[model samples]
Target: MIYAIGAVVGLIGGIKVYNKFSSGDPDTSKTAASWFGACIFLIVAATILRSFFL
Candidate 1:
């Protein structure tokens, strides 16, 4: 379930980054980094919660 959510978020982020890249946006790298961080944070948080609760 958590992974499924992560996949969705990844797909959305990928599309957003691609758009930014195609448009030659100056902050594209920053956007990508933030999105990547969000995905990683989600995974890590889920893992920590599962380990603590289950």
Candidate 2:
């Protein structure tokens, strides 16, 4: 369900952050930022929908 999607977003964010701080291109920071945003959106949307549905 939505929780699964949200978890995926979180994992993506973690990978992005790790990449940005570890061995990724410095110019790819924006990609990491986008992942952070996606994680926020997924968590918020999931929370709202979960609240509504259950």
Candidate 3:
């Protein structure tokens, strides 16, 4: 559940980063990268948690 929340937060952050970069607002490449990392981490964690719990 915590991992899922992390993923959702990461998704929202990534979307914000994408929108900024694509709209000529700012680069935000680092933020996007961090968000990507967070998303991947959460996904893996969630998968592992599920495997262990269910």
Q: What is the lDDT of residue 33 in candidate 2?
A: 73
Superior candidate under lDDT, 2 versus 3:
3
**Tens-digit lDDT track for model 2 on 3-37?**
68878878877876787778756757777778878
TM-scores of the models, in the order given: 0.94, 0.58, 0.59
Between 1 and 2, whose lDDT is larger?
A: 1
Say which prediction, candidate 1 or candidate 3, comes out ahead on lDDT: 1
Ranking by lDDT: 1, 3, 2
> In candidate 3, what are the lDDT values of residues 1-54, reduced to their tens digit?
777698679879977997888887756887787888888888888889889988
The residue-level lDDT of candidate 1 at 33 comes to 97
Q: For each predicted model, how many residue pairs clash, with residues at least 3 apart or on different chains?
A: 0, 0, 0
Q: What lDDT score is found at residue 29 in candidate 2?
A: 74
lDDT (10s digit) by residue, model 1, range 1-54: 887898899999999999999999999999999999989988998999999999
**Cα lDDT of all candidates, in order?**
0.94, 0.78, 0.82
Error of 3 at 18 (Å): 3.7
